[model samples]
Target: MTTPRYKRILLKLSGEALMGDQGFGISPSMIKYVAREIRSITDIGCEVAVVVGGGNIFRGIAASSYNMDRASADHMGMLATVINSLALQDALEHSGVQTRVQTAISMHEVAEPYILRRAVRHLEKGRVVIFAAGTGNPYFTTDTAAVLRAQEIHAEMLMKATKVDGLYDSDPAINENAAFIKHISYMSVLERQLKVMDMTAISLAMDNDLPLVVFNLSDEGSMLRVVCGESVGSRIDNVTDGKNRVDRTAAVSESYH
Candidate 1:
């Protein structure tokens, strides 16, 4: 297998990944497992940063089905990330990794506010910094926050750890015959509206030339696979203002098959 191409990577993990097989909230065993994977990456010489989503506990926008105010709902979502970040910090520490949880919204009791320089300093010192609170504002998903933070920290790539292995032409879970694209362009992603991520997030990543490595976090060694430059999932990078570019040296296919 080919090695991972990135030196400093910002991993964007959805809260649902922490849920494991549970219906809601985090599973201790699962968190520990994920933390171990991250530890493996850091053990190699790569600086790892994380932007965790709070979807498992709450997604303010998705909660519109209940008619909650969009801003209030988003704030609640931010709070949920704080909870998740704390859990992850504890888990990482348990695995012998020093971590710091930084939030956009100030919660001095639990973590430091999201200060870009401070977070970068932590990474420089070899500490895993968990960015929480989704940009410290409402009406934005954590996906956008991930792009913004990843860009600000000058992360070489964004390792998007999702339930799915990679971007697909159709819903792989629902459509058995869906095919995964080994490589795709930004125009293709938007022209098709593939729903890999929001336009704002993708645009930001595109402008900054930050690659998005979409992979499955549920697997045992996916995180290491991403760090080691192995063929594990789909990578989005604008070759010429592109969106998601697959690694040419590795098996860059999605698991929709």
Candidate 2:
């Protein structure tokens, strides 16, 4: 059996990833696909915890931009995360992976309240723990919540699942001339004002020196490859040896598959 790179990891999934080809809301097929991907890692004895966003259902920042109260909008966004969490829980359970949903906001009826010790216990028992509700506070994003939970659980690494194969100098979707960055320092990301993560989340991860891997979720076996220590995504950390060096040549020549 191939040994996994990290014993424990935190995966951050954007709510938009759950939508698949749909215009809005959760897509059952996407959730099931994610469940299978997660199960692959667990089958190899890797402990996994996830933080899912709710942008597909509701985006607090966008709402606030349209004249809604910021706090109320954020709270509503948190609830959207809860809904995503439940859907994920159901999918995981159906896939035969034991799962638990922990909410930052207290809602005992739907899930257990966020308790550090219990969450650790659940992972120790081989169950995947899904954190929802975005830190139970207003003005915070799921990105920040993922970092906080990862630090609290002492995860070996943080994995961010995105649509892009890796981090690029510019949006690869529109700019074909963008350069691919294989590795970057957290400070470089912040200084360059990259969209890898929100400033608060990047700052928090930087302060704690938590390594983050951003990869394409749509690619089959991408998560498994990442867990197995393959160069499956762009990595961000404190390493300064070759930080901020863009790979324009690799961008055109290398294939993620």
Query: What TM-score would every model get versus the actual structure?
Result: 0.90, 0.95
lDDT (Cα, tens digit) per residue for candidate 1, span 74-167: 9999999989989999999999999999999988988998888999999988899999998998878888999999988888888888777688
Clashes of each: 9, 0
- Name the lDDT of candidate 2: 0.92
How high is the lDDT of residue 217 in model 1? 80
**Top-lDDT candidate index:** 2
lDDT of 2 by residue, 100-163 (tens): 9999999999999999999999999999999999899999999999999999999999999988
List runs of model 2 lying over 4 Å from the truth: 249-257
